[model samples]
Target: MADQRLERLIRQLQRHTVVGLDTAVFIYHFEAHPRYLPLTRVALSRIQQGHQQGVTSTITLMELTVRPCQLGRRAVAYHYEALLVNFPNLLLVEIDRSVARRGAQLRARFRVRPAEALQVAAALTHGASAFLTNDHGLARLNPIIDIIQLDD
Candidate 1:
């Protein structure tokens, strides 16, 4: 069941344009998250299949920095640096004033979290055609963007 599901996702990601990766996807790039293996693998395959451009908000880097710390400062530093160095294709979209304003409005209107809002904002700012997130709150904001729920 999972294999077929994973394959379908892999195919979809191959044609993705400016994919927006949530914090969960970033974390999986380092140590393994058993539950996220399928999603992560599909994301990676997409990158391999010419979907090289990955859009992520500054907050994702902040959130990702926290998890690697659990492994220790050195490990965190190495992993974070490695990710930045290797993924030149990864675009770090800043959560600037404009994004903040948009996020605030989305929060007021849809009641989504700041982090999720930031992700969507990044995607929109970068002209991303699709958003990759495990966050369910995105369903509410579907009218604004195309969200591909990794958890589903």
Candidate 2:
């Protein structure tokens, strides 16, 4: 069953040349969440292997580092920052004016959080064909960009 799920995820990921990774995906991988780590591992491996390109908003860095910083795990936070910045075939997209405008529209229409909207906006603006996330609310964005839910 695990192998089947992993294979299915790989197939889904292969369908997209560029995939946008959400912050939750990274958190799962970082924490090695038992249920979702396999999925995130496959997704990230595809990017690391150069089979597909990965994109994520800079907001992800902030999200990933906050808890660690709060817990006084500065070293861990720095490690995550370094990994994110230097990850292979992954682009950390900056939030710009165009992204901000699109994010505002998504936020208003979809009623998602500001960071979530900006992440999707960055993905769309940067030519991502699919966005990988665990947040079910983001599934509403399928019409805009394919939303690949980890659990599904």
Candidate 3:
């Protein structure tokens, strides 16, 4: 079960139909580290249950597969790729022209990396009311979209 603060955050996010996911969410859930795994897994399970729809940049596919691919664990990569593509309530957003342009703008304004900018831009482009990630640093972007940091 989630702690009080996390539970509150999840309840608040449930109010919105669509939420943006960062790559770390996928990594943490699939890899399952001791400290953060529980929260990340529960959060994803909630989305998978169709309670709140999840939207993520297609870049997530690349990010999720890199390690397993490097280690010749093709099956591991395939599992995550399939999950991202086939999940019913989840929408894997692509970095199209509009997203690229907006991502550049976001990059210029905030102290964010290109990947983070792209993820945030994808969420903004598609009208997601909240963005979820373990990166507490993204709280700086709250003015543009609600930043829901799972690790916080």
Candidate 4:
């Protein structure tokens, strides 16, 4: 937790040329998680301002929309979908064959779920400096791309 302070994260965000978003980032933002929303919003604003590039896989949209769609909250689902699609300076990486192939390898090696593997693969494929997430487990995973744990 000491290592994951907000101030240090902001500096790291400034230093990294590119970072990837995981579905949790959107989930926190949309669900207004008290612990994570502030930093997530600030980082995203910085990205939108062109401070650094942000990228995520199309799988993110699928993940983000699930609960809302399941609850018949079409507006909320649409909101999530639209936000991911139109975020400024954010690149939505498609799950092409190359990404799928890489994800398959990641799945075999890391035992991560297919969607999670795809997300990591997409970030790596896009040359992101780090993959930003709140998943504490991923912090220890030693991915090819840096995994910045927002929750420490």
Q: Check candidate 3 and list the clashing pairs.
A: none
lDDT of 1 by residue, 1-152 (tens): 77776876776666666787787776765667887776787686666456657788878778888755765786776777567546756777888888888778878888888888877887777877777777787888778776777666
How does each model score on TM-score? 0.84, 0.96, 0.91, 0.91
Instruction: Say which prediction, candidate 2 or candidate 3, comes out ahead on TM-score.
Output: 2
Task: Give the alpha-carbon lDDT of every model.
Answer: 0.75, 0.93, 0.85, 0.84
lDDT of 3 by residue, 1-152 (tens): 45775677768687787889999988887888776677777667878898888889889999999999999999989998998999777889988999999999998898788999999999888878899888887888989888888765
Q: Model 2, which residues run further than 4 Å from truth?
A: none
**Weakest ten-residue segment in model 2 by summed lDDT:** 143-152
For model 3, the run of ten residues with the poorest summed lDDT: 1-10
Worst lDDT 10-window in candidate 1: 44-53
Whole-structure CA lDDT of model 4: 0.84
Of the two candidates 2 and 3, the one with more favorable lDDT, higher being better, is 2
- All predictions: root-mean-square deviation over Cα? 2.2, 1.0, 1.7, 2.1
- Per-candidate clashes come to 0, 0, 0, 0
When 3 and 4 are scored with TM-score, the better candidate is 3
- How well does candidate 1 score on lDDT at residue 134? 78
Worst 10 residues of 4 by lDDT: 136-145
Output the lDDT of residue 119, model 3. Answer: 94
Task: Using lDDT, rank the candidates from best to worst.
Answer: 2, 3, 4, 1
- Give the best candidate by TM-score: 2
The better candidate by lDDT, 3 or 4, is 3
Better of 1 and 3 by lDDT: 3
Report the C-alpha lDDT of model 2 over 1-152, residue by residue, as the tens digit. Answer: 88988888888898999999999999999999999999999899899999999999999999999999999999999999999999999999999999999999999988999999999999988899899998999988888888988886
